[model samples]
Target: MYPTHSLLEKIKLYSIILWPILVTQISYHAMNVIDTMMSGRAGTTDLAGVAVGSSLWAPILTGFNGILMAVTPIIGHLLGKGEKQEISRSVLQALYLSVVLAVVVYVAGVLFLPSILSLMQLEAEVAYIAKHYLIGLSIGLVPLFASNVLRFFFDAQGYTRITMVILLITLPISAFLNYLLIFGSFGFPRLGGIGAGYATGLTYWIIFGLSLLMTKRIPSIRAYRLFSHWIRPSLSAWKAQLALGLPMGLSIFFEASIFSFVTLLVSRMFTTDIIAAHQAALNFSSLLFMIPLSMSMALTIVVAYEMGAGRVKDAKQYSWMGIALSMLIITIASVFLYFLREPVAYLYTDHPDVVALAMSFFLFAIFYQLSDAAQATLQGVLRGYKDATVPFVIALISYWGIGIPSGYWLATQTNLGPFGFWIGIIIGLTSAAIGFWIRLYYINRRFSSLRS
Candidate 1:
């Protein structure tokens, strides 16, 4: 095909896209670490309040972002076919969708925050703090989604560096804001956990504004005249995006909420130390997990672009190359986690019980390495083909239908204690990986046969 890159060239191209994403994830993880450390230092109640509040809020934001994510591949495929004009139109439709989605999400999430908090049966002060925090965060959802629209446009134009730089630039400022507001430092009121929310919301709005300016001025974006014209919602285009977005959004919600559900439902039965240990293991694994996730995102970009350009064979090659690279990297990384579980556990907390509890899960965590990588990368492969419904269903079945009940059964019904819950995660991830890999194989075969 006219747009085909050689295998070696594909490798280089993949690296270019992957590294920024990797760096961006790493940097964002750093921000999370800082958030945790600072919040922990403030007080346990503050930390707990933030955690509870975040659990309720994060999935909603993630689900909404999933809807927005459809635009990335849409723009990618368009760019691949040299359809610059179409890119402008597609992105505008994305913008319209974001506006409507943002309004709906913000209104619903904020309006229902109190009732949800009450359902959690949290302490009065904790509930109050969490409610206010959720409100603060909700205030910024529209701007956040809008920035995401700009982000997709940039990514499709092959300039992820803008996003990476913007995020990296925001980290220090965000950290500083949190610090000042959290502890009443620099003469700020000590709003505690609520401060974290306000700081985050304000930062998001600021970033959103900056993104708008950047979108207007960036050479690549300016050419699209993305902001120069008004774009109303086209039912057909919105429907296409929704078709992909709803399943993807639900899939993300399913996967992310499972862990939250485990923490909320299963953790109550365990000690605080056990919960902390599980969290520590989760943090370490999540940081390490970013590599595969980045590779997946890169794979989606490459595959979508190649497929749209009618380089079906190249699309297949990209998919497999990405899967191979992810599995290989994760395998090596998992070995380190298994062997150095102690030190890794120690880095998070000095509590012996927490460390012991954390150590117990390293084996299972190691087991998750290949399965998690496979599932995540396969999801990306499917995303390139705009195939989300199947993966979403697979994740639903694996995580909820299988993993949740299994973990609960083992944790409560069996003698496995809290460790049983983690075992379920392993099972679920493995099942999903198997399903996704199978589906991806068929998707690849179909794409590879696309010669006219």
Candidate 2:
């Protein structure tokens, strides 16, 4: 067990982990911003294509990545228990699993993406860009998946700075490549928005290479010898990870896919300008979302470590602290979003109509920030406790069972038009926040009683 610490000490420790994580999360997500902004500059059709492609891609990526996230808590628990010997084996198995998942996602995308896009009934060029953008992205899935497991391994050990440094190194390279390929700058062929996908895919390979180097060369990490010994694929390990990870992944998928589904629904009903505007606002909102998301990720690590050591009280403290902090930061962020909505809208497109619609969407985005932060951070706290199944159920019911249907009805049936979908999102997130709060309360009581 670890020694007890004052709140100030805990804050310091948390900050050490959180700030790097926040930077990395923001920088990594900035690639999406780069994609949106650069492609927006190309043309509205390009912007809309990327947006729809992203709508199709983000949920799949998040779901699989979320599955890979089980590695973080698994390593966190092992560290808390001082089981250093098992770290390399667990991570290696996760890598093997990543390869398999990558192949599966790639195959599925190749087979089904065209059909999916066709169903959306997008314009011809828009359809081409969207299809090729995903195909380009699919090329990097293997590295992307593998590096994510490596990232989780590092994060679980409280080495977020390593990933942060790597991302810092990669972000500019990605942006430069995006510029070259998207606009045909410096003689690179003009791929427009489709080039963004290729740039992102190439960046993933670079990240994987750097991540492996860090694993092999870093003195402290080298002690784990993650590569010195290769553990053959083991069914039991796969089962263990899947058991914990599948629910967590599905929970994330449920939440993320709701937005994607909304985009798809919007694509069906809205004009290109409207779709561009919606994508622009949604993209900005997603960037802001990384703030709470980073907090939630940190909570998962710290809370898992505390819970693993049987310090339920400390776990509770960290959980509440992170949740409270997330709410506070998002509140401040919402204020900025309100004041700067117009400039922010202009960043995505110069088109007056798109900018106007995007600004309006920002209000709804602002309205949901608190509930979103609360629910997201609470999910992190529960994951730390190794409690995922119930949250998955809650997310599904809230997002699909309630959120989507409500949004669709409002958007289609009411005079609210596009705004109706935003309201549905508010309802869904608020419901999730309320449901997760009740679940955490019960979970806390159970763990506290056990501790007593």
Q: Go through the candidates in order and give the clash count of each.
A: 0, 0
Model 1 Cα lDDT, one tens digit per residue, 161-247:
777888888888888988988889989999887888887877788778878888777775677787678776799999988998889
CA RMSD of each candidate after superposition: 2.4, 1.0
Error of 2 at 48 (Å): 0.3
TM-score of every model versus the real structure: 0.92, 0.99
lDDT score of model 2? 0.92
Q: Identify the candidate with maximal lDDT.
A: 2
Residue 395 miss distance in model 1 (angstroms): 1.8
- Candidate 1 CA-lDDT value: 0.78
Please, what is the whole-model Cα lDDT of each candidate in the order they appear?
0.78, 0.92
Candidate 2 similarity to native, TM-score: 0.99
